[model samples]
Target chain A: MISNKQILLLTSLLIFSAASILFSLLSGSVDITLAEIAGSILSAETNLNSQVLHQIRIPRIQAAFVTGGLLALSGAIMQVLLRNPLADPYILGISGGAAVGALSAILLGASGFWLSNAAFAGALFSIFLVFGIANKFGDWSVTRLLLTGVVVSAGWGAVINILLTTSSTNNVQSMLFWLMGDLSQSRVNLAHYLLLIAGLAGGLLLSRSLNVFIRGELLAVSLGVNVQALRLLLFFSASVFTATAVTIAGSVGFVGLIVPHMLRLLGARDHRFLIPSCILLGGSFLVLADSLARTIVAPQQLPVGVVTAVIGVPAFILILRSTIRK
Target chain B: MATLHIQSLTLEVAKKTLCRDLNLQIQQNESWCLLGRNGAGKTTLLHSLIKQRVIDEGSVLLDGTDIADLKQRELARKIGILFQQGIEALPATVFETVMLGRHPHLQSLLLDNEKDIEIAEQALAVFELDSLKARPVDTLSGGELQRLALALLLAQAPEIFLLDEPSNHLDVAFQIKLLTVLTDKVREASASLIMATHDINLASRFCDNIILLLEGGEALVGKCSDVLTEENLSKAYGCPIQSVHSGEHRLFYPA
Candidate 1:
């Protein structure tokens, strides 16, 4: 049954998300006044402020929010799928594959659309590679999948290092920006929003089975959950989410690894609540972090990934310590 | 009421035969205990009965339906199993853990209804875990965890119960009390139970039938009194066993 406390927490998160998005819209290299924002909304004027708001800030915010939601949602599912609390979206080498693809495209003089396509293709390739190898005998255990993913990720890491060393200096800066997850050039299409919504809905639908699964696989099977089917579904869904997020923002870290843990530590362990909450909280957290990244230096931007790590590590440590003290 | 039938069941692990051509017929309201030493295949047999493991040969049927043909959810509504280990992975409140037993009965994308909540609550009360329902499962002691596991099975309310070492981590007094409550509940519902345990005395006291798995993949199954001879137990355990008459009950002890 849904509890009133969960409802209250979710409502608070929803409000917080809206407020963070508003703050992100308002804060940037060139500060747009509240009056100007209201004017831009109320009157469809093609002024400079309106142009910046519509063309630059709004798309970047949407990109950040959706990417954050996807990453956090994927992290939550990965934790359950691998039955490890430390599991993150990137643990299965999805981002590694995406990075390799994106970097290869960059080397070949591809940008934007083609870069994303390359990243997605590489992610899919890595996904199938891991799935194929781990499930070679048709009965892949969790440890096997984890080992294969980690080993494949290491392989990708080597490839990524090689690419970094071989690329021209002019291209390296942009490549680093993509790898560190820059929102300056990030944009969201309709498909990104759809994938985020689909991921959230799918997570909710499987929330009950996930709840049963965390206890143990044998217990899940005995309780009527088709463990094999559930594992397959989780693997693909989480992989797809990670892939999409990577293609959008090029591997934002910490949001995926910490947002879900923060929620769990706050007592949102129930997947029914955790899934949606991850979307709201993770999205807002990134929107706020990106805002800080944009205005922290003003005119010169910091990568959103750096900002997320800088903020996430200490906040998580504090939460962990307090939880332990309790 | 549901019956479990195992015909010519053969189970193996790592190319070693755990059991061969084992036939069993468990009728309604019957409680059977699997008594075997370590690696004698008690857990393997229970797993095979529930179709959790692939059998080398033969079939397991529930109410005349082959379990292999039934869906996991269908089988779950008719049969429940309490594993040997307690919850060690997830962090959840005791109440939430117990409520997971209702998972099989829930419709897709729907919440647990009031009836399901009531059943879970009643199971918590039965296990004397009402005070700890709000407490996190990871914080509970081993005995409390074991009791919670049993409570979850009660919430499942299946027609057949399969328990592996249900007495593990249970204190002496609570063990007797919980086992008594469990057996009484099974009898009241006219459901059958199959338990795998290492305690010969406990099995002798609680079960109506005995399945003693010996070395060489051979098994002796019959009424408790008929198959629980000193020789059979000694052979099954590969040890010298002695029995003592405790008024109306016969208890086994190693010599």
Candidate 2:
């Protein structure tokens, strides 16, 4: 059953998400005042402010929000799937594979759309590689899967280093930006939104079984959950979510790891509440971080990944401390 | 009524035969105890009965249907198992943990109904854990955790219960109380019970049938009066055992 406190938390997160989106839109290089934004929206004005809002800010905000939602949702699912609290979307080599793809693309003079496609293809390749090796014996244990993922991730890291070492200085800077997660050139379409919504809906549908699953695999099996089927679904779903997010944002860090932990610390441990709350809180967190990234240096933009870690580490520490005190 | 029939079953672990040609018929409302020392295959036998473990040979049937043919959900409705180890520490509350027992019955994508909540609450009350329903499971003590596990099994209400070392970590008083409650529940529901344990006295006191697993894959299975003798237990345990009759009850001790 959903408690009143959980309902309140969800409501607060929804409000926070809206406010963050608004803040990101209003505070850019050329700061548009509240009245100017309102006038542009209320009337069909072709003002410069409106042009910037429609063409640039709107798409970037959507990309950031959806990417964050996808990452956090994947992280939550991964923690349950691996039954390890430290497990994030990237722990399974998806991000490393994507990094290798994007780095290689940068070296080959591929920019924009091709770079994104390369990253996505790399992510898929890593997903299958890890899965194929782990399930080679027909029945894959959790330990085997985790070990396989870790080893594959290490291999990807080595390839990424080689690409970085051989690249020219100018190419290296762009490669570093991509590695640190830049959203300046990021955009989203209808499909990204649909994927986020589908992921949320699917997560909610599986929430109850996930609650039982967290206890243990054997316990879930005894409780009539199709453990093998549920595990396969979780693996692929988390992989797809991670792949899509990395493709859009280039390995934005900490949002996935911190958002779900924050929700759990705030007493929303149930999957039904945890899943939706992860989307709301994660999207808002990234929006706020990206806003700070854009405005803190004003035009000389820091990477969103740096901003996320800068904000996320201290916030996570505070939450962890308070929970331990309780 | 539900029944379990094991036909000409054989089991091995790491090339060592655990049992051979073991036939057992567990009828409705019966209580069976598996008594053996460490590595005596009590747990292995229990797992095999529920199809959780692969048997070397033969079939295990639930009401004349082979268990291998049944889906996991179908099997869950008819049988429940309590593992030997304590539950892992998680962020779930006591009530939420017990409510998981209703998972097999609840439909997908639907919230638990009022009846499911009531059942969970009643299970908590039965274990004297009603006051701690909202407490996190990780905070429970060993004895309390054991009681909680038993309460969850009660809520599950399967036709057959297979427990591995069910009495582990329980105090003397709670041990008797909980075992009595289990036997009473089994009798009232006309369900069967198969428990594996090292406590000979407890097995003699609670079970109607005894299965003594001995060395080299041999076994002795019969009524409690016939199978729970000093000679049988000593042979099964690889040690001398002495028994004394006290007020219509026979208690065994190491000699």
Candidate 3:
């Protein structure tokens, strides 16, 4: 028998996703009618306003949806991989490492085309470093992995701070803005970016072997799961997804840390359900958060990160409290 | 038929020899009990037989194939292991936990089919655990959990059953019940049942064969009547042990 809360959550996510896309199209700084926006998406050449709407608004909306969705999915997968309720996307130092890479590339005057690449490489490298340190201790203890992740994150944080201190004022502002997470500057094709997200999402869904891993590494190995290979593969894919999200929209907070657990607390433990729910809800939540950030201050805008944290913390606390009672 | 051959198996952990130069065999249709005092490596020897603990300098062969060469699932298919203690912290229902026995049989993507459910239900029926099927495992009393573990092992449908201290947490009645149920299974399936126990009397009464393990790295494997002598018990336990026999059953008492 299915719980009513699960049905409610699934229903709410679908409704929110539809509403978020509509809001994404309608409620930007400059208002555009729904009909005109539809016309712009359908026939860009027929309407002058269509060109501005298609180029500027559509990508921003898609970026918010995809990045938010993927980050939440990554958070869910990572928590299960570590078997710790508190684990999230940043627990492996992926975001911290990506920040260092993105900032370094920016400060060193790299072209816009290379920014995402540098960030992806940095995230991969930091995850490898953390994994190496954890391996040195001879077991994948959650406490060891968490401590190692913190140390690696601190190391990357120091590097980014040092770069910021030495860089010119102009570069520092850009670095700070990116680190704060802004989707206003993203202009990538939605189809291309969605493909990467879908692939990583597919890989995570295929990790049903992870169910055995949840029992313990020894149990997983004894159950015919290649524990080491599966661990490395999961680490690599989760980091790539996080790095791509970072590259696309700077570094958004809270969504990656909060949404997957929220789904789980709402009774979706199976990854097949949890992962897709995260995608839909995460994308919709972030888009809604971004929209709120734009409109809350009227003519001025707050950072989307600030909006998400403000909205996410209380809900997260409520979920945490309820889960403990359970 | 399942046969296990352990040739000179030794295990050392943290520079202490847990088991040294141990050799044993279990043929089909045999119920063998390992008798030892605390820290005498009875459980370690059982673990070695099941391939849970890697042997240092020997080979464990099952049905003529090296255990190390078998895939974990394949090994599990041939041998069912009941741990010394129940694993807590998982909020698994008795049915779900018992269904885990089918892990070796079912693919990860597929749900437990009717055949798997039938096997699990049969196991539950054998152990008389159908009434407690929906209870969370952690909530069960020690005896109930032990019975549940036995049911799980039965569901695994293994050719050999390896149990570590199956009677440790049980009451006298449950202990006898567990042993009788296991002996019955061994008889019915033509499977070898190997158990580690500190209760020599229970071992002698219920087991067809007994291996008396001494603390100083010696193992005496033979019939129960041959191994449970006062001299051997006292030497292995490092204390004065007196024995009394009633019919085929022998009881060991500390003097």
Q: Which window of 10 residues has the lowest lDDT sum in candidate 1 chain B?
A: B84-93
lDDT of each: 0.91, 0.90, 0.77
Order of candidate numbers by lDDT, starting with the best:
1, 2, 3
What is model 2's DockQ versus the real complex? Answer: 0.70
Candidate 3 residue lDDT tens string, A1-326: 13466568778889989999888778866778988877777763656567556776677788898889778877876876777877777877888888888898998788367877787788878878888888896767667777888788888889988989999999997788778887777655656466556744574555446544665665454344566667766666777777778878878988987898788677665454566688888889899888888788978777788888998999889988987796
lDDT of 2 by residue, B119-198 (tens): 88998898899999999999999988888898888888899999898899998898899999888988999999999999
Native contacts retained by candidate 1:
0.80
Interface RMSD per candidate (angstroms): 1.4, 1.4, 3.6
The first chain of model 3 has a TM-score of 0.86
Per-residue lDDT tens digits for candidate 1, residues B1-255, read: 899888998888888887889998999999999999899899988887667898889899898999999999999999999888756634688999999899888654757788888999999999999999888887898999999999999999999999999999998899899999999999999999999999888899999898899887889989998999899999999999999998989989999
Residue A94 CA error for candidate 2 (Å)? 0.8
TM-score of chain B of each: 0.98, 0.97, 0.93
The CA root-mean-square deviation of candidate 2, after full C-alpha superposition on the true structure, stands at: 1.5
| Per-residue lDDT of model 1, residues A85-156, tens digit only | 889999999999999999999999999899989999999999999999999998999999999999999999
Q: Model 2, residue A107: what's the lDDT?
A: 91
Better of 2 and 3 by TM-score: 2
All candidates in order of DockQ, best leading: 1, 2, 3
Q: Report the lDDT tens digits of candidate 2 across residue range A195-269.
A: 999999999999988998999987888888888899999999999999999999999988889899999999888
TM-score of chain A of each: 0.97, 0.98, 0.86
Better of 2 and 3 by lDDT: 2
